[model samples]
Target: MNTQDPLSIGIVGLGNIGRYHAEQLTSLMGSFDIELSGGMDIAPTARDRFESSFGVPTYEDHEKLYETVDSVIITTPNRYHEEYAVSALESDINVLIEKPIAHTIESADRVATAAAASDGVCMIGFHNRFASPVQVLKQYQQQARFGDVHHIEAKYIRRRGVPGRGTWFTEEAASGGGALIDIGAHAIDLALYILDFPQVTEVSGVTRSIFGGRPDYTHLEMWGRSGEGPFNVDDSASAFIRCADGSTISLDVAWAANRPPNNEFVVQGNDAGARLDLSDGDLTIFESSSAGAPHFSDSEVRTRDDDPHRIEQQRFIQASRASEAPTVNTVEQALTVQRVMDATYRSNERGRAVKIDSEPLPTVD
Candidate 1:
């Protein structure tokens, strides 16, 4: 496909995130020479809603949707990621799959293998990496500003933020694990990206289902339908990860907890340290003076107002048009993060640290 031609993009799964992507793509059409080739959702109501809101065609079948567009954005539930992504890749259609790649390492590997064999571009949606502050940190890391990194600490906690308490999110079979696979995936990806995705040597972790199935659990807001259903997933998880380079990472994620909400990523290096507040996208750098005098410097790096989701989509479009892979949000990177997450769950189950033997996958470029 010529880069100059208007790229046609379709969305599969017209759920919350899918709708958001559709809106963003629509907004982007004003600037980019592209076409919103409608969307697909299994639910009839969702399809009707999407078609009514966007005045674009909506299909009940993914194959039909795939036949209409050059690229596909998969916003389906975790369980369906592999199926949709593999199908799209097999059809020579570019794909941008929402994060975690798939619910399990096996499924993620299938998607990765498909991407490796396909000529079309494939990217995982780790939109947090597109944040201005994260971009700056990436720049700093590239320049070796944080020489000899020692460790990274990432937290994506919530006082009460469980989604669909009785829905697919609370079901292990549908959403994989709980907090670790959901928001925790973002934290892990961000930390790994900052650390240049060092191979994880070992992982020790624990998960809890404290709040799920609790009738008294309270939150500022609730997502999806709330009712009596199986809530078998973890509500909180913590993990200690050791990398091949001797650097360590401490990760904590929770959908509901008793503590105050905190969302941040801190990278600690021998020479300098940096912190990114995931809540506001603000980055703070800490450094000591090289002079004899004992002095410290703390600087806050302001972030851009750019919507990360939009930035992510724009890049996906650009890469797809060029038939090139994304440098940051590649399938390999997602696979690495997935491996760490899988290791975390395994460690929790084994009640000890689990050894990670999977080597990093090569990048498409």
Candidate 2:
């Protein structure tokens, strides 16, 4: 096979995000060389509509689709990511899983093990890492713009926003948890990526179902409309983490909070600080001063320029070709995030600090 030739890709789970990937691939037509091998989805309605609209063969079973494509993209719910990804990788097919990897740390471990055992590449979808502004921040870190990183604060706050609430999202068995596991996963991943993934030594957290636990809370809407159904999961969560390097990360996430000003990720260091606001694709940098003049100074600014999805796709394909390890959120990183989530919930339930299970995460490399 020619190294320059495009690879065949089979996408599993043709949901809304999956459709976006398909459209993006088609939009790149001539410039972006690739073949859409087709897809598989358990949903009959989704499969029929996707095949009819895209003119791509649809497989009801993923095993049949895996036999046809060189690589598979898993975009199913968080709970199913590990099962699907492991199945694909075990069959010697590369896999690109959507965010969060899996609902549990143990499942994440299985996915990583399968990837390591097979002769295929595996990568997790952390699209924010591909943004231009984020890339600049990474470059700044490489250049030591932020000397001796120490603290991070991330917020994924939304104003009355919970997707498919009372549906799969609110169900702990299906879409994982509520807003924290869904959106907060991205924020946590981004913060860890920026900080070079410091080893978390301890985590203390709390979860709240302030809005969805009451009878009157039934009026709250989910996904898009009002009163979709009953929501039982936490609408918000907050945590504090101490890293092995003595650095710290403060995280807060919400599906529907009465707070003003949407979402942001602020990374502070001894020498400088970089803040990325989710509402807009902007990153503001501030320089720290040892000598007193209000304690901080301003520095160079960077902004996102390209579509994060496109860059992420290109990177995954390239990594697949090389059979190289994932530099970003591999299974190990994902499991770490899951550990934090699990501990947070446990702490919330027990009304105290939950001890983390100290175990080394498996590596894709």
Candidate 3:
């Protein structure tokens, strides 16, 4: 495939996420050199919907779609992530895999190892890092304007946004650990990214199945039909993470809670601090100036609401074109996130803070 030609992109798992990628890629067609080669899914309804909605070919299996694309995006359930991602990397096809890396640490390692060895580029989908607010905040941190950033408070809670019962999201075996692995992945990645991926030392966490597991749980205008099937996964979680650099993170995420929705992230630094909404991209910076009288200052900065998904897709195309691994949002970073999650679960089980191993993460050469 010539780099000059548009990159042929295929999507596995034509569900809501796959369709979302299709929408973002279409918007990028006029700007970036990309072509939606096709999509693959086993479900007839999903395939039919994707084919009709995007006017693209849909496949029942990956092999057929693999032949026509230069790159692939895997948006399948957590457990199936390794299957598609590893296969695509083995084929020397560039890959953009959605987060949590895989369902478990073992599975995530397999994906990371494959990404390290493969000739093709592999970038993890930690799209929130591309949001305007995060991008701007990262610039300030990079410039040393925020001094030594030491802590972050990340929140991504929903008032009553739990998925319907019996869906793959509600299944422990399929979705991994529920809210922790779902939204928690985003919060962890953003916090670490803001801190420049320092070595994690330990994690203390508590997970609760509070609302979703009950047969008597009230729907009250929540997602999908409530009280239908088994709900064994957690609905909310809280965790604290410590890093080798002495930086820290407090994570709070949920699919369903009694309080109103919250999507805020606060980064605390020695000289300055920053705050942003994870979903809305609103940003505010905090600092104290002693130019005249000693006083504190808070300034709000607004930026173009460029869709993070679209920016992520654009970067993936650039990586695929160069056949080089992305410098940021690498599979290695995603694996680190998986490690934190694994430790958090262990911490919950042991009722104590879990120490993370100091082993080096796999890196692409």
lDDT of 2 by residue, 111-227 (tens): 878987888888888787788878888888878888887888889887777676566677777766787788888878888887788777677888888765555544344563334
- Pull out the clashing pairs in model 3: none
Q: What does the lDDT read for residue 50 in candidate 1? A: 93
Distance (Å) between predicted and true CA of 227, model 3?
9.7
**What lDDT does candidate 1 reach at residue 63?**
95
Can you write out model 3's per-residue Cα lDDT over 65-93, one digit (the tens) per residue? Answer: 99999999999989999999999999999
Judge candidate 1 against the unseen true structure and give its global Cα lDDT, from 0 to 1: 0.89
Name model 3 segments beyond 4 Å from true.
219-229
How accurate locally, in lDDT, is each candidate?
A: 0.89, 0.79, 0.89
Q: Write the per-residue lDDT of candidate 1 for residues 1-365, one digit (tens) a residue.
A: 56667999999989899999999999999888899988998899999999989888999889999888899999998999999999999998999999889999999989888898898889999999988899999899888888988899999999988988877788889889788999999999999999898888899999988987787877779777775668998899999999988999999999988899999988899889999897977889999995888899998898667899999999998898888887869888898899899998998899999998866574464
Ten contiguous residues with the weakest lDDT in model 3: 220-229
Which pairs of residues collide in model 2? none
> In model 1, how large is the Cα lDDT of residue 190?
92
Candidate 1 wrong stretches, greater than 4 Å: 1-4, 290-292, 359-365
